[model samples]
Target chain A: MTTTTKNNEPIITVRGLRNTFGEQVIHENLDLDVRRGEILGVVGGSGTGKSVLMRSIIGLQTPDDGEIEVLGESMIGRSEDEAKNIRRRWGILFQNGALFSTLTVAENVEVPIREYFPYIRPPVIDEIASYKIAMSGLPANAGPKYPSELSGGMRKRAGLARALALDPELLFLDEPTAGLDPIGAAAFDELIASLQKRLDLTVFLITHDLDTLITICDRVAVLADRKVIAVDTIPNLLALDHPWIQEYFNGPRGRTAALSHKEGAAA
Target chain B: MAANGAGKARSSGVLPTEFISRTTSRDMADVNGTSDDHQGESVYRVAGALTITRAATTQREIDALPDPLTIDLSEIDRMDTVGAWLVYRAVRDRGAKVVGASRDEVSLLHQVSEFDVPARVRPEESSSFTRVLTELGEWVADAGSTLLGLLGFFGATLIGFANLIRRPKRFRVNAVVQRFDVVGVRALGIIGLMSFLIGIVIAQQGSVQLEQFGAEVYTINLIGRITVRELGTLMTAIMVAGRSGSAFAAQLGTMKITEEIDAMRTIGVSPIEALVIPRMIAAVIMMPLLAFWAMLMALLGGGIFVWLSLEIPPLTYVQRLQEVTPITDLWIGLIKAPVFGFIIALAGCFQGMLVQGNSEEVGLRTTTAVVQSIFLVIVLDAVFAVFFSSIGWR
Candidate 1:
């Protein structure tokens, strides 16, 4: 079915996805696709279910009804082993960097590697984990520190390293820049952009950070009114007359991001 | 031309499109059957995706070709990391032959193959004896700190009590009453039902055993003595440890995590007085009352069981219960209640206050609180039993 798209295949494809909590409809007939080797940004107002949408795709939150496919495998009703296999292929960095409090940063990075690649020697796993930690932009000495000891930004990096433990093809980030300062957030955005290119990762980035969208995202999907209203490049999105999109993109913050992006491109 | 096609991407490496063009959609050489791209001798034309998602099919297509076959990179469309890896694997298998990839493809393929697995170095394993010694040392340190924490909390509560005595306006009466209503009043149904069933089991079991010695009437003595002296307060304490003890840990631990306790301290409000002192006072006041209620429920259950099964009348059961159980037994049991309550409350508050960070800490500490409280309760009961036995209470 996807062969008709000509060149690139979607790493993730969701068609008519619906999710609700009791009478609260979070998403309805929502559709999205994360193409391979593309950083796709998901943006929405609060309570529009950006996290809920990510959670659904990752199998953390089950949708009420929908079709979700990842790498040609249906994710909606997949068995545990199948789901586990899919999970092994992709990694999710939660909003708060939910690293296990008991483990050091290095050990946290080794969790998925240990789970999926049990035959790999612990020493090799340790080496790979450290490499991944370094790759995620943390210093070599940061690996021994506990999550609680690290700053908010450092914890997010540790979580990214842990997510990249298996060298996943796809990366899901939930508000990666939510808690960081502007410079830190921009650095994070650059780190993600570099990592995506180096690893050929298909990134599903859920963020409220306009700078992240302008800097890294190849395409941005706007979620509104319980479904995806528009999916296009930031430039194309800016031209839309949708009230929410207009306010969100033409707001002071959005204007600053656009100006900075133009200056960055020129520089 | 190659640089122009690579677009504004900062990385000079072959973008996924390093292998772009020449597939024409009709011939998916990489995914299915090999297409004839007779660029040169021994050329195996590849097309379509060669990424990780389709690595299996793509690898199979590459493998089916004759050895020493060259992969025509120009015939391929998209080549990602895994796709590059599979191509590299083919190249490694073929043992280096003539190659012709676009500049982008060559660079990407080169970078992809650079991901090499390094040698492993095992972590050092400590000797079992040394590990055990270290563990023992840590345990002792932990015990000391825990004891100190409990004592410190106790002293803080006492000082708060003194302050409250001096100026009653500092008291959070509403909070104290709320804690009392939740901890004391809410737990009644479960405590009552459990005691009644325990009473029935004791009475029935005692009657059977005593009947063997032609002393069936001694069921009264067994029920009265055991319920008043041991089971009443002991069971109530254990139940509260599970119920209210864990609650206190969770509540206070959550407060600590959310910085509410820190906020209180910042505002010159003592957490001990506002949180711990109220719970302690409530427990101290309620434990004796709850134990007395549990004792009555147990006696009622015992009376009903004996009357129904052993043909003992209710009036006779009551009179016999009074004769066997002295008022001193009641006092001994009631006296232990407050002490047990204080210990349970202290255990919960200690663990709760110990919470350093995270929601998981709250949960872990809550479990620890319940376990420590119940173990302490049983230990206290045993200590009291020994003291009463030494004084010839029985």
Candidate 2:
């Protein structure tokens, strides 16, 4: 496959986005753009609406007020059919491996494929599903295993495979490496980086792993004080003079992650 | 945990479609698209993108041919794994050969062709008589095992009680009281209302049947005998099975799935003692109280009907109830309440502990808990009926 970078345009653009639950305002006057071929990592402290932002973008949650544009089209005021068509172009992997528990890993991947292309033959669907499964770094035998039979890491990969079933141009991943061991987490990060390059995919990743952000994020967005206070490269983000940013980057975990990245670069 | 940084990205977004089309296409004009060999073997042609979007086109071209056929990918523009699979599926079991495939296409076909284990074959339908007989045998086996499981659960509960007797300080009084409130106190209104309406309907129907024989006053005897001897305990058990028993199963099943029970074991706490005992004790304590209240409501309801319809005075109705129905009926009904409570609790706990895997199993076991408990309740009540009759309690 020919791989050419298409990086100028934004696939997702959000502006003046406000969400409120009674008197609590999660976001206000927030503006952000997710460009076409980048892995954009969104990080925030707990209760800062990182997931809410992702939810708002994917149309799972409606903002009280906002102008959301996806794929150069305004999404805020679209009809249901219009919204669904836009949503069909993208795939989302929810936190906690939101797989159908009753279905096997292969069947879970086939759900979206079947939904999108009902007339596709079952054997062809299985082939596509198996390919996606292999692409996600899962073992060949994982296809027939049920979600409950899988470990946490395997479930995450299965979820990723399902998300890729539609050959989506854009992918949204929520906390892809939260509960994994250090080695598993690193392997996951590499898998993501490899896939991002191979597919030339635009990835919206929500994560809390410092190493993940440092190693793979093309650009990082920091949510603070009810909105994104900074968006930049790893070095620029580290140099910022914000208190939470300072504590977060200069923190023990961040220092180690930075050291490890530097050593790897030198090696 | 995102990396926050300054603005410019070297690149972000998808690769252009041009990159995919940039791959060199090998044009071998010597090979023709379709050929039917002399051995009755057919060959089809495949072309176009083999990706998800273009897979259907390639599928249609190959799937229309007969089995034991070959496909020529010589004229194919592109083929991905999805496309490769479509071709493979058509030629899987047949005496078919693939000719003129590209190196990439050939590898992809090989990669997806091998199944470590093929998809489990679909179950075939059996003959009707054999199917019925098999189902009958399975049900009998299920019933046998379920009975044994129930008896084991009862013994385990009794052992837990014996341990409690040795260590009274370990009892969870708060848990027992909480369950009593949920299963007993909360159930009063419904149980009372149901038994009262039952009493009223029975009296009304009995009045109609006995009025022709000039025995309208006998409705008092009918209401007292049935309600005290059967309906009061039976209704209480049925309601408890639906509400408290099902709740017990769901609660334990959730704990089992979440590994809370496992946690308890690792920490040296028995799930039987911590979870099952309190519910069992609450059920035992509450069932009789609820059944007694139900019996009293039924008497009051029958009294209402007798006083209103037959113009029977309250004092006369009371005298008739006292004389016609012996104290033995109330005793028999009360004897059943605690037993039914024990059975319901055991059924719930048994099914709950049997839970494995996921939330679906939790729900399935919960339904089975209620059905099994209610069925056991009915069967035991029947046994009681037979026993009491043989002993001439009436």
Candidate 2, residue B39: the lDDT equals: 52
TM-score of each: 0.80, 0.83
Specify the CAPRI tier of model 1. Answer: incorrect
Worst 10 residues of 1 chain B by lDDT: B1-10
What C-alpha RMSD does candidate 2 show over the true interface residues after superposing them?
9.0
Candidate 2 local lDDT, residue A31:
94
| Best candidate according to TM-score | 2
Report the CA-based lDDT of candidate 1 relative to the real structure. 0.80
TM-score (chain A only) for the predictions, listed in order: 0.96, 0.96
For all predictions in the order shown, the interface RMSD in Å is 8.0, 9.0
RMSD, candidate 1, Å? 7.1
The local lDDT score (0 to 100) that residue B205 gets in candidate 2 is 97
Candidate 2 stretches greater than 4 Å from native: A1-4, A74-79, B1-54, B62-149, B211-214, B306-315
lDDT of 2 by residue, A78-133 (tens): 78888767766677888988999878899999998887788887876777787778
